[model samples]
Target chain A: MLITRVKKKDAILSLCKGKTLLIACFGCKEVHFEEKEYQALKEDLKTSNLNISGEIQLDYLCNDDYTNKRFELHKKEIDEAETIIIFSCGVGVQTFAGLIPGKTVLSGCDTYVLPGFSGFTPSSHDCEQCGECMLGFTVGICPVTACSKGLLNGQCGGAKKGKCEVSKNKDCGWERIYNRMTVLKKDDLTLKKMIRVRNYNK
Target chain B: MHFTELTKMGKFVITSELGPPKGFHIEKALHEAELVWPHVHAINVTDNQSSVMRLSGLAMCKVLKDKNIEPVFQVTCRDRNRLALQSDILSAALFGIDNLLLLTGDHTTLGDHKDAKPVFDLDSVSLAYMVKHLEEGKDLAGNALDGEPPKFCKGAVVSPCAEPLEPQLFKMEKKIKAGIQFFQTQAVYEADKFEKFMKRVKEFGVPVYVGIVVLKSVGMARFMNENVAGINVPDNIIEELKKDKEKTKSGQTGIEISARLIKELKPLCQGVHLMPLGWDDKVPEILKLSGIIAEKG
Candidate 1:
């Protein structure tokens, strides 16, 4: 489950000058939302003289059909609102914006990563789906997700003592790749082969 | 006039870095450049080195060129997009500056301007590729140049002392494939490790210059050990610096240490890139002490 933090009250208040519709997605199963903080936000908004046209809290806001159905049910309230504030992951905000065109859809929350298991399953590795997979050559360590900079060419000169400079707790992805390649006795061959430059268009 | 020609003739090339000042007063900076002129073959004008805002490297290169000193134009992907980078490349060419050092600059967060947006539109490898395309009279979009396309002697950076060194080697090979003519490595403090690194780098057939950064004091050494990436200043060097109880003379000790490293590293690589880190006046001393050049009369 993606970890999210609510945007500052003042910043959220600024985007919601007119009558605003609020859609807060608690996310799918196993996701955690700070109910106290969210409730405090609604109370603060009310105290700040914000016109709350409608409030809808639901799960799976990224699901287009589910979100569209929810919108239909709240059509009257949605129609009256001048701004739509979605408190969810980036994907959910984008999905809402995509469904309702020409509307000021603003994100009320920011998404952050929690190291492992970014997808549905509880796995050690996560793929960013960068289109071109270097996992085969890298012996399964995904550099795009693992490296803080998402450097594709190789390791930047930022890793120190097997740990990443950006995040001290994290292992240097290229160091892991190097160690794995050595274990498999593929380092020599890997060194000879030119690493393909990342196709940014992909 | 390419310094690469010296490498072709098997001369042990010597280069140094010149950080553009934060403000417009460039008299001291120019004097610093002249101080090392008798010692170094070329000077690399840093492009916001360490992510700190400074005078434009291209502008400084032009200034250095006016003094007849060969300048290596250092460009980073941290500040500009493809359009601005291409424009600047052509502009550098227009000024008759041909030597280029392409780098994926340190992140913007590391600099004085922490809130600045970093634009890594083209990395060093891709920038080298773009330069190759530009040399062929084409821009990145295949647009033809109005005049003679710029030809540059392009160089790139590598971290030879990186832990699990194969990834750096992999990238180095890719850079060479991307038409990078030479390489200047990240600060190296260990001789044995660099010797091993050079053994692999030699197969690539590109001139690899060992970078020697002067460690100013015990604090600086410890700071780099804890903070800087890929630079591991061994405890022995720190102990050596600490032995110089006169903190004022630490600069002298730092010069001694750098000269010693350059002396040890001279045989292992094609050249030495001295990064004195504001100790510009000490470069001639370091060069003379390392036996790179004779003592001036």
Candidate 2:
């Protein structure tokens, strides 16, 4: 699932200062999309100078076929409005803009994405998609994404107290790899082998 | 001694860089190579260094080889795909070039030819691994090589004074794992920090040739500080350069400073990789002043 957050309310207000139509994606496929946060922004827009001509709660706005059908169903309401604000990620906003030419399609949300797992549910884990995957060798903990230094072999000397030397807040990925490997009875998963460079194009 | 030979002999190896001319100024490139060849163990040929197009580094290495000067062929990942990179390894070997330095080159947009597409099919680490594979007589796809494997003294670049130093350290480990035998650091001015960095790097057990870029003027130092990513020039060095108004005096002072840095960093590092920044002829003076070589009678 893709992650997203609302654009600044003040900027959205100015973009929709005139009569406008609000297309909100209620069915955002994030592990946890702040539905109430969007509701709060809608409340604030109600108090602003922008007159809401119509509102459509969209599901899977990034789906071009579904979006096309929805737009056709609400053609009268959309054409009547001066500006259209799509409350979703960049993909949804781009889809609306590309599908409806000459329409004022403004993005109400900014895309905050990580490399998403295909299966549903939000995860803090992100795979940089560096083509080559070394998860099996490192006991499933990704050093490429988790480690501050992105080291493939042993950890740099900077790791202290199982925390990253660069990013103090983050856990050292190598430490986790070590601990996990110990648990799995694989004491030497990372031993005696030189890990090659990660290729991101994969 | 050659670079690897000197380092292995524990003789505090010294290497210097030589930028091939941007145009087909073959004579000028040869002249520059001849100028710095004697003072250092080996001359590193730049691969269109700083993202500016120039004569290819492999060609320059062949040039230096013909002159009986050992060359470290610097290869960048910015211009070539994996196939080209592997092929270049064979070509460098066939040309009798043994030293190889791999780098993730500067973006093409940083160069004059912005429109040219950058083929980053392999980064520095990957390229280093590919070279290792070539040495092992196998291609990246695990295919058998046609003949004898290429032999090389592999090296890579590092920036020890990087603001967040861990990333650089991390990549250094990766380079080592990829079979890199040596390293050349970016311009380093923080002597204390570099000492600490080298102390940590010693555990990796590879020779690092500390990079000393001669800063000839306050403007040049400031330009590097602002424009270059990992190079950090201390204010005192900048103020020292600013003290001298005469170009000759400042240039001489720059050489002294570079020599001093080399002398100070000698204990912590295995060698010095001098980057003279167009002042290629001053290399001998720097070596003499740094006590790496003796003054003439």
Candidate 3:
């Protein structure tokens, strides 16, 4: 599940106008929706003089068929609204926008990152699904997600004392890889075999 | 002179860096280069060092080339995409600049333009690979060049003081495989630590130049320790800079510290790359004190 935070009130208010429809996606079981904060934002929109045509809560806005079926149930409310505000991750916003053409669709939240697996089962690492996985060589620590720059070759010069320069609190991914290699006695092989350039086309 | 030829001849090379002026006027930058040109084999022109916007290093390299000075054109993967980077490489070749220093520059957030988009379309290793392919008369797409292809004595940067030195070594090896002829490391303060790094680096069989960044003051040294990555300014140097605080002779002290570092590191590496960080005028004095050059009569 992707972590996200609500965008600033003024930013959401700017896109909102007459007969605005609010759609909230709260399907991710692991993610908690701040119902109180959502209510507070609704109150804020009302104070800002925006006409609320209707409010709809749906599961998995990113799933096109589900969103399409839900939108059909609220066809009159969807058509009456001048603008649609979706409180979901970027993917869901884009999915909703693609389904409804010629309507002003704006995102009410911005997605941030979490350090866990992207798949359904929780794990310590994430796989960006770059098609070509180097987990076997890198000792299972994914540098693509662990390193801020997603550098595939190795560590950039910014790592210091086992910490990343980009985020001081985060452990340097390469340092982890190095420690793992040493423990497994694979440092020699790592030094000998050169990692090829990542096929970005993948 | 080609840097590759100098290294091949086993010459103890000395190189310094020049940061181009932010404005169009290149007079001051040229003057600074003139100060250390006599003392060093080649001068590296930084590409918006630290991600701060400045005059293009390529333009400064052309200016230096016109002055009959050898320039090591520094290219970073921060600003340009693959197409623009390839074009610039050819442009540098057209201007008769042969030496190239490839770097994965500091992120955009660290620069003056915080909101600017970073384009790491091709990283330092990939860039070196691109250069190798270009030298073979083709682009990365396997297209043939119409005429003579460009040749370069490619160099890359390494961080010797990295906490986990193995990864840096791993990347250095990759760079070597990518046709990088030599390496210039990030600022190294602890000679003992650098010595250890050099011991492993020797197995790679590529020339490694130890980097020496002058520490201007205790505050500056402390700031770098707290902020800059892959750099650890030792307490002894900080204390030395602190001793000069009363007399405001930190600048002199900085030169002395750098010269001392060069002396200690000289035996451990193939050459030294001095990064004066705006104290270009003091490079000559540092070189003389370090015994890299003879004192003027």
Candidate 4:
């Protein structure tokens, strides 16, 4: 149901009667532009545009309130929308997919649009939203985002000269940890503080 | 009144940052202010820290000032245009709160409302100049105010050890030219780095207050390193922190490190600006380490 302008012909050709679609714009602001692009998309249907006949609703969430909303609302959106197109980057898109039970298409915002990478699909049911948000405990580096190996409690020892082994430009989590300790003036005490493994299991 | 006089009179130079609550809980924000009134020299109400809207910084500063805590209003240039920015500065002076910390706040992209549109009114340097011009009874466009402008104890921020320290120093020079009386730096973890930064600028003769942010947890320490720009954390220390987890949980490990930094840096600077973050109660412990008692002068 989340068809891009590029796939408009195919989308209209295979339209189902009772299906509902939801276009989500969260975390990124390029949604305005994306919305504009979709307005200009070529339509091959008899109606010329993919019309949802009032059953479809558009719900948008920016970073401000989206990060803290109740999961029930997100669940309702997913259930209502036959197809969802998300314009966001990184874990936000993936997390939204995890919250909703269905397939979703991903698009990057203008600022986040990396060269050659179009979007991503859910590879596996990776995160089990254990009712705990540990972005703080992890020093802002999500194990799901930066760490390719997905080691939770500790970082992989694969950094050379502050770059990650997998992606040379990517900073190894430990390098960030070291820099953070120095700025806080707790260099000597950095090694002493222990953070327990955050359990995000459902 | 001058900040020096307030400090000299044995009046506690108490300061606090008004973190606007997540919701429309003005009473809760006031309650937070009351908790620190007895100990603060001034309550510094921040203007939409990280550029996310919560409460108006000016209104909150006025509210705290009404409650008898001197308000050191913080103004950042991330949102306002110059005209609005200057008008707000004058309005703050008219409202009677004197202390100010001019900051070039977080980028608009970093905040919750990225699409909310950003207006880089002016950088901290120009803001400092604006403050000076108003003090001289002139507007930014050279128009003179109707009456005598108010005097303010204007201050600015700098991270001496930031990756590129020269720009900060250059800005400091501009602030000095713009009539800044004091400076508070980003948190100081490395006394040696601060000492080196101070050594180069001692000739400026401004009373530099080294920012001392007490690390509440190892996680907090690592968060600052990763997210906060212009902050550098050494490697060996992170390795050590990773190895010894048991001793740090009680926070004694952090306290000791803070005490050591304070003890070393106390002699080189005018005074320490202890940023407790949320841990304001431990300030006394830090004061003890710096050998600074409640000044009776």
Model 3 over residues A1-202: C-alpha lDDT tens digits? 4565666677677545578999898867644456667778888888878888889998677677777888899888888887788876555665676566545566676554455745242323344545344443555455666776677777778877778876778888877766666664542364335545566664
What TM-scores do the predictions have? 0.71, 0.65, 0.73, 0.56
Per-residue lDDT of model 3, residues B96-177, tens digit only: 9999999888878788998999877677788898899999999988899779999899999998987767778878888898
> For each candidate, what is the lDDT?
0.79, 0.73, 0.79, 0.57
Among the numbered candidates, top DockQ falls to 3
Candidate 1 per-residue lDDT, tens place, A1-202, comes to 4566676787677545479888899877534456678888988888889988879888777677878898798888777887778776655665676566545566676555455666362234444544444443444455676776666666777778888876778888777766665654542354344545555554
lDDT of 4 at B74: 85
- Considering summed lDDT, which 10 consecutive residues are worst modelled in model 4 chain B? B7-16
Chain A fold similarity by TM-score, each prediction: 0.58, 0.55, 0.57, 0.33
Tens digits of per-residue lDDT, candidate 4, B1-297, equal: 556565445343434466766666688778766765555456677788866787878888888777776777888877787789888888888888888888767656567887766554456666777788888989877898988887899987777666545435645676677677878777777777888999989998877777777766667778777756555556544554566577566556666677777788877776566666655556566666656554432
Error of 2 at B69 (Å): 0.8
Model 2, span B7-59: residue lDDT tens: 77667777888888888768977888788877777889999886789988998
Better of 1 and 4 by TM-score: 1
How high is the lDDT of residue A18 in model 1? Answer: 79
Candidate 1 chain B least-lDDT 10 residues: B288-297
Residue range A1-202, candidate 4, lDDT tens digits: 1222222334323322233343434223222234555434322332545443222222333232443364454555556555444333334434444444233222222112223433433332222222232323333234444444333333322334455544556665544543443443332321223322233222
**At residue A12, what lDDT does model 1 achieve?**
70
TM-score of 1: 0.71
Per-residue CA lDDT of model 1 for B1-297, tens digit only, reads 676788887788889999999998899899999998888888999999988999999999999999988899999988998889999999999888979999878878788998998777677777888899899999988899888878899999999887767778877878888889999999999999999998887788899899999988887888998888878899999998888668526488888889899999988888999898889999998888999852122
- Error (Å) of candidate 3 at residue B22 is 1.6
Candidate 2: the clashing residue pairs are: A31-A122, A131-A202
- Ranking of candidates on lDDT, top first: 3, 1, 2, 4
Choose 2 or 4, whichever is better by TM-score: 2
